[model samples]
Target: MPTTARVVVLEGDFGVCAIQELELPDPGPHQAVLEIYAAGIEHGQLQQVEEPQPLPVIPGREGTARVLEVGSEVTRCKVDDVVLITPWSADPGREPELPLVEFDDGTETEVAPAGSWGTNLILDEQFVVPIPNLMDKEGASVLGNTTLFAASAVRTAGVGEGDSAAVFGCAGVGLSTIAAAAAAGAGTIIAVARDDERLEAATASGATETLNLSSAAAVERIAELVPGGVDHLFDCVYEFETASRPGRTPVRDGGSALVVGLPGTEERQDDLDA
Candidate 1:
């Protein structure tokens, strides 16, 4: 008999999930069994639901977990240590070995690389990162995903002191990008959103100016504010027509416009500008 874990399983329909009991897998020589404390839902996982992938899928990509069991060769953490669970493997060059979810009757569903959204998960030692227990589990989980994404975008774009930056969409990740830019000494930061509430949130996150997409011409407004154009444009919203086109308009020639968000629907190659 193995330990039972509750997993969120998505069967035929898209965006629908059901709770089911599954038998936890034993840790492999280089793996650890983790008891997840807090999990964050990533947009990539949600996007997968609509695309063609195996059904009865488990959809969490990042989380905070407590190590419960380790294999003979595992040296990452002890039984009670807390760790961060990332979808990407510790070794990027190799394909990840995913654990199967076993049902009561001994039937098993083979899940690919992504870990389950469940109470217990068996993962490779490299996927579990030991962290200081100072921050709450919820906040730590967020830091691994959304905040990490924002930081990566800012650093990759080489946004420096006194550079004009604009963020299109003030959701969680968007707000995080705004804060990161301000912390890096950005000169003028413009936050664009479809509503006032998001704009207000962006302001609180250190945005110097806010624009409501529905109320005015976003590209023109941003150009007026930035003069020549913005140095960096980060788009985190996914509209059907403007997956990220509108935000790209404000970037100066040769400037970077990073699409940090996931698209709701895929567009044909012909529809996009070169």
Candidate 2:
């Protein structure tokens, strides 16, 4: 049976977001319907809303919910199971592209709309990961993407016990990386940012040292702390000049500099050249 769901839709015009009622389709053969309990709002979602996209699309990427119904082929979860809604499938073997929506004008466009802000959601079983019984929904919602990104960054950098790491950016992803690095037994976790509050948060998250990028001698100070640069440099902000400067580079020779954030088109071009 179809159900009406209140969804936050972003119109084609930039910066227009509103709630509207829409009929949600029933779960497909390999899908499940969920009652969303909590959804996370991140800076990436804010950037998405500001960019031009297909009209009247739902804008959300991470959430937590309880399974209300499942299709016949679904076996990973059952009704009433708490699950985290991940942007990609939990199963690494399968990679399914987002479904394309066709407009009344007969024009079709591939809009990767995640309708998690709605009261209910119907997603493929692959995208839902069963959550622990004691975990809070709000925390679980942000955990999926935030932790995954941090873990991926650590893995990419090959950070290991007694290794030194420098995280450039004290935002959600950067702070998460610090925590993960600490948990992995990193010898020194340095957090770099401009904001004092975020720097403090970074310290609490397990940063052994913090650098204020606004300071004129910040790069020199980092070099002074770790004479030969850090073993791993996680660039979460992707600032073109700062991240690519050879004189002020944060990574040691042959060390990995992992960029985990999206850069602007011009910056990307510059990065390619560098």
Candidate 3:
């Protein structure tokens, strides 16, 4: 008898189902079987789905695993290979061998590839990134996602050496933005958050200064710290709309404000005489 795998299943009725006992499939010419090590939880899961997530869906988006088998034509991975699977929604311009993973949690039963919170996952060769031996697994997992966001934000802001930058929000991505900004040589970094604990962590992480946004003057205070106003600002706060406003108003006339936060919306660009 072949081994059976337990996985989560999602129904179209806004419900999650847990299903078990799946028969494993043999690797395709470009596929491999992976034993999941760990997976990261992201806020994207909270987004409302219209089509009702595919039934018997596996909902994890990011995970680390070890390969157990490979397809006849697959050259990317072999048994025992540690890999981090991050399937991009866009054509990442890399390769297409990797299949996008989705989880369905509607039903109470489990299913394969419908959820990756379980032990085993079958993936394509192009979807796997080799885990480096020297890198810490726990740290690299978070860094992988953060680095991608940082790269895009940094590039969008045209951040470079000597540019004064301020980052609003002290969460993972915010902290990553701070690090990237500092590495890019932003002379000053002001990290903004609502509490003292996270603010302190932001400072320790790389923020030149930290401020609490619980009060109304948080934006004004940050401007006072960066007298000339920041040249660039990165907003990573999803709920706080004001975070972006301060950086937008306080920054120099020619400065740029980059909003990387979520809950996508359309806002008219502030009209300022350049």
lDDT of 1 at 131: 90
Candidate ordering by lDDT (highest first): 2, 1, 3
Q: For each candidate in the order shown, give its overall lDDT on alpha carbons.
A: 0.76, 0.77, 0.65
Q: Tell me the deviation in Å of residue 239 in model 3.
A: 1.8
Q: What is the lDDT of residue 254 in candidate 1?
A: 84
- The RMSD (Cα, Å) of candidate 2 is 3.1
- Please list the residue runs of candidate 3 whose C-alpha ends up more than 4 Å from where it truly belongs after superposition: 1-4, 48-51, 72-78, 89-91, 94-115, 241-249, 264-274
TM-score to true structure, per model: 0.83, 0.86, 0.75
Candidate 1 vs 3: which has more TM-score: 1
Compared with the true structure, model 1 gives a TM-score of 0.83
Top TM-score hit = 2
| Candidate 1, pairs of clashing residues | none
Candidates 2 and 3 compared: the better one by TM-score is 2
Candidate 3 lDDT, tens digit per residue, 1-274? 1224565444456554466445556666777787777766655433422236545455665677778888888776677877776653233464444334333322343222313456777766766677775666655655435556665798788888888887877877888888888888877888888879988888887788887888778788867877877888787764566444544547877888877645343342232111
Candidate 2 local lDDT, 1-274, one digit each (tens): 8756777777668777777666556777777878899988887767867887657577787889999988888888999999888776666686543434443345454435256877977777887889886898888888766677788789877889998888888889899999999988899988888899999999999999998888777767778888888898887776636533323556788888877767646756576467
Error of 2 at 123 (Å): 1.0
